[model samples]
Target chain A: MSAKLNATNTLRVTRIASVKTENQTTKTYTFKDARCAKAKPGQFLMLWIPQIDEIPLSIMNTEGNSVSVTVKAVGDATRHLHNMKQGETIGVRGPFGNHFTQNNGNVLLVGGGTGTAPLLFLAKQLATKTKRLSFIIGAKTKNELLFLNQLDPLCTEQPVAATEDGTYGLKCLATQPLETLLAEEGKEKFKMVYACGPEAMTRQVFNLTEKHGVQMEASLERLMRCGIGLCGSCMIGKYRVCKDGPVFNSQQLREVKDELGISKLGFDGNRIPL
Target chain B: MNSNPLSTRLAGLELRNPTALASGILGYSPESLQRIAEAGAGAVVTKSVGLTPRVGYPNPTVVQANCGIINAMGLPNPGIAEYASEIRYAKTVLTVPFIVSVYGYSAEEYAAVAKAAATAGADAVELNVSCPHVKETGSEIGQNPKLLTQVIRQVKAATSKPVIVKLSPNVTDIVEIAQAASAAGADALTAVNTVRAIAIDAETALPILSNTRGGLSGPAVKPIALRCVYDIYEKVKTPIIGCGGITTWKDAVEFILAGASAVQIGTALAQKNPAVFQTINRGITAYLKKKKYRSIKEIVGKAQRN
Candidate 1:
């Protein structure tokens, strides 16, 4: 007997409407889905590329009936996704994960590499709500710094741009500019620090936020399957990165901080040093 | 479909429906467990807790294959002492029966955890004898009938609550173990845990799970689980909680017909939210109405006589 029926988690085939090449290794693909347009900042969608296997992608930007996902061609699945042509079909499964907590007052937004995808969306949302906002964008080089042009108009002051090679704004890590910014203005200037990036950078952001006593929320990355919290692959300690957070407040981050940047469990459940 | 005929009894525990939150899937915390109950599970089982806190295996703890997921979480849980508060908190919020699933290296340790759970207001204690990932415990204990019996007896002696011995599917004859648990005074039996299995990366020429091996659960193991329940039904009289790859209401029905009094859902919850319990319950209720059965008990084991 055919057991096939409409189930909640079934992947819906969506047409890729457009694609934007962000940098050398990163590209953002836009797909037509009304559900995603309403998705909160920091929520992710599981994209299926047929035989390549399903993987979670953060909603980079959304407008009208289209949602965009910034893909970094690092793994086999992502490499295959990068090669796909626009208008070709793919499966979209979510808008999953707990979103960043939005509040009033100034907020420091930091992002590095492709991790800038969700933070860019958060910045856009917070720009309308917060009294002030500043962005700290980081990458290995200026070419890899993401979303600075888009973030420029939304910030009260110039967004801090940092690249390892000194090709852009600051000649240091993303957190370095924030360290100076926080020290100059004091912790009360920025109500919270929001970050998503390399684990090492996120760890640094966490430490700076803690030292300054400023609240912080960070998006964590892990190998995940079944993004709704069933598969335990995306867990850091007791928390499921996909469920408890893709974005975690400082308090939540502190609980699982022991396992955070120290190591990440591989797809085979082996600990890989971060 | 809504004459309220879905309520049923498993051994002595009353259930509003046959659907339960199976152990090891989203049972890590009381908040999550309470949420699952709010979503419509008849009962909830906590993740198996041992005597001491365990970090469990490193990642790739759970991996998806074509048919199901292979997880070697190694039964990671806070020790009973620490998890007791979670149990108490969960009990205060839960309207459904709270079944604490416990595991340990020895019968004495199992009894200690079960006692703590019972004191913390667990409606039942599910002795996790069949978890395939953990060594010297789980299936290692469950695969041996004598050891399984000792563990069950110890837990039973320690708690006034119902004792459900969860069985392993890796055994040559699950019936032998089931009968032994039944004779040893197990109030009920969760017919199967994940089957011992492995997944490998064809590209990397390596095993996919961090532990290299894990137990498989999902739509793939339903047939095996059904056969297990059917076999145990023929040889043992204890109420069976069939739990392997039961993803739909129809799958739940098949287990009931095979003599499972209730079904525990795990892997399916990964695909969807806790709402699957209510969806399955509604579907089961509709099926019962369509079949002209007044209650699920009327259909339980109906296919076995033939």
Candidate 2:
């Protein structure tokens, strides 16, 4: 009757090596983590902030012996995470999920809000693999645009930046350039499009990518618990986003299209309009 | 996959592997159940469904506790009338046995749902007598030996398929309840369900789950569940299907050595992914090879002799 589990399956403590402000509401925390470094670009790690709650944050970047996650203080846990100083430790559980499947060819990357974090990680992985890579990022205002400087060198060409207020790059939404790109090239110029953003923006990406017949994989954000597939909190249709994906290809996205822009299950387990 | 020495039988039901997807974890839809089978579950049990439609408990249904999780998801399901189609759909794709878990407020409702599931092509029926969060449904019917007999008797009479009663760990003496279900004609017994528990927010001093209290599962409840199985095996003749915090192959083997014919895996599926079934199965087979045991039959209840 007496048995012990792999202790590593539970929360492991890691020290915050550094913190850098990404914007007013978000900060990138670099932790001295070796266990979580193996996480793929599209996967997420469950960050347990003591006394708050555990929340899933996309893996922003990983360097030698350290992993970084960009947190937007939209909720209590995120706010507590953003306020943490160096030398403080937090619990980390995973880098769980199926990551973005790399493809060879010219690529288009789209990011919105804090959604840019995982895309930034993906771009870093795809930098050398693709023939040419470009980015189109959007935020409510210029200050909210994440990882612009970090993404600059990674892009094969100049990245397009968009903000609704025209405070940054283009005044139109990020989808405008994508619409124009697909309209101009008709899916021939870029081999695929990778996007991570709000549901509305990602839904638009799904529509435009489908119209253009170009391959697209979008990183989806869903309320998650237990990051493993069991909790059922992160279900988008039959796919448990935590297990099957936080990343879904155009084809897989279509299967769950009914729930994509329609609704999402909330923290209370009730279906709420997206 | 071909049968190996690790193949096990509970009553007349045979499993290619000793690991099954326990009720209430990824058992909702046909596609998810199909994927679980592909991941290597010998059998997959559908989530607990009642006679009528229930949305279960509201948000904050699940939360991570010390070493596992607490969930008060009040058995949310589309009524059996509609879920039967889902069972049929799952049957189309699943190569393994599909066990339907049913719950009701009375013996008649339990028997009705079991009959509906059997007619819908369920290979077997698992009586969910122990969801700790829901009221007058799971634990209420499970904890009483007399009431347990009535429910099991009616269900056994209603369906020709094998009936497996999932017992609760909240009772004082689980062996008494197990003996009653076996004496009443339950084909097999799922040794234990989640223990009653709750989690609180430190800052607010309020219970974390929306339902206030929920059932605790994962590694934390393993020892208690094992003890129940060990205790029940000595008194009951019916085979025991062990569940509760079985995360690894070693965990699964421990349950079998403690007297479980096959073990149902729930919480481990969350952390290790669906592929965990195959990983645990491989580990079990390797252990069998290492110990020179002929089969799982040789291992079941071996601890009782000791």
Candidate 3:
């Protein structure tokens, strides 16, 4: 609501390191924007070309202003955005929204599809701060799984990967490993939980963390136009998914209505309507 | 992007710059307007108000798909009496002039609201001649060039301050309406209101919007908005407040070059991160500084070297 705080006020192109495909529809952009390296967790920025439209992208991690955005070639803007190369200078607008809070105890991280990008950045932060951390990630099939191999080195135990097809880790759902880990380690093992993915899965992750009385924060997605509150396109329940969220802790999600497939979690930790 | 002072007279009101917040987005509440305008917008257009208070449509009132949004707000607004109070309230906060936007089914209604807005200390009155919700056959007063002329002229006659005529983009020929409006005493033109459209529920088999049809705006509609502004600017002498799908300063510059004296931000304002006028103005200033262009007037409509 305040004037846009520029996390990337002064930035220029670092270079496109490489591009990796995550599914027929999504691609991971590994580029360097010197401005993005200064961004904090939960903050996002606007990436755009001069003539093309501007679009908001959550900064994945910055190795000195050299940032990356994992994009899905869904439409003309993104399709064209993905085809660009390393040397091109795309404009950066933010490092916007609230950042994930830091905790020094045991933690759990989960994600699905390209939603992993933000959590991956959070994981990188957790890697240095937390005593023990575990991750659970999922994809529709093996091909959709991204960054898990990279995530392995950052955690105590490798991320428990899941795919709908038995092509990855548990061959069940990503939540399965969390419940197993909880049962074995006891509910009090982790002090906090962080997750991002589809509404259905984020809701499930919320329920589990809530039962353990563990604090959890999530990155939720909505149809956003302005990436600011003025457009009113990305409202969910009473809050603006663009302004108020895109990231919400368990306590914040409780205030939101469940209509958009995100009612409170069922007792067993599954999204009810879905 | 010329910086030689882009401020111009809209209905004789001096806009610090050429952009204004389009009607239907910013409400009469000064707090919201102040939050946005502080970012360096040219002006803020209060949401369209009328003789009677309107509650507007139900929730899910806004949604996004691909590059744009479909909104069927039904011009929900507080009646003039309450609206005037809010305008007075906002005036205390905003440094820029607050342009009042009002709509009605008939000429008398427009004039009455225009009078109320003037009494409320509104800087100017923008007569909304193009809301597509009138009767379905055509806009009640806006589509017919003669009726448009009559309505705008009456509104102008009613208000001492300048009167701007807002036109819909759905017409087979938009320029005709712009020309007619210009000739009828309109002081400025706000080109290209929403293009009427509808969404359907594949599951329930009903129109998605409660009002049955809504106006579409966003990145998808910029070209159409630009074309309308370009066409209207050439046909009329009135200043133009170009709107629709304008999210960046580059888009703003295009509207100016296409002959818009100023532009308004609609759906783009709803999202939180608008490097909008501040970023855009800076970008414009930089472009001007870089090119040694003297003023915005210098390059308006001067196409790039293709």
Best by lDDT: 2
Q: Residue-wise lDDT of candidate 2 within A1-274, one digit each (tens)?
A: 1122233334566678899987789899988777678778898887767556667889988988789998888876677788889988676767677788887798999999999999999999999899889899999999998889989999988899999999999998999988987787444577889999998999999999999888899988887765767756677877998888989999899999988878986653445798
- Residue B49 lDDT in candidate 1: 83
For all predicted structures, in order, the TM-scores are 0.68, 0.76, 0.57
Whichever of 1 and 3 has more DockQ, that candidate is 1
Best by TM-score: 2
In candidate 1, stretches whose alpha carbon ends up further than 4 angstroms from where it belongs are A1-117, A120-157, A160-228, A231-274, B1-3
For residue A80, model 3's alpha carbon misses the true position, in angstroms, by: 42
Q: After superposition, how far is residue B257 of candidate 2 from its true place, in Å?
A: 3.1
Candidate 2 docking band: incorrect
* DockQ rank order: 2, 1, 3
Q: lDDT by residue for model 3 over B101-144, one digit each (tens)?
A: 88776788888988988887888888877776545212557778
Q: Answer with 1 or 2, whichever has the higher lDDT.
A: 2
Question: lDDT score, residue A61, model 2?
Answer: 89
| Candidate 1 per-residue C-alpha lDDT over B1-306 given as tens digits, one digit per residue, 9 for 90 to 100 | 555688888868889999999988775565567778888999988778888877676544655555677778777666888778878888888899999999999999999999999998899999999989878999999999888888888988898999999999999999999999999999998989999999765544556566889998888899999999999998899999999988889999999999999999998876666789989999999999999999998988887975
Q: Native contacts retained per candidate?
A: 0.11, 0.20, 0.10
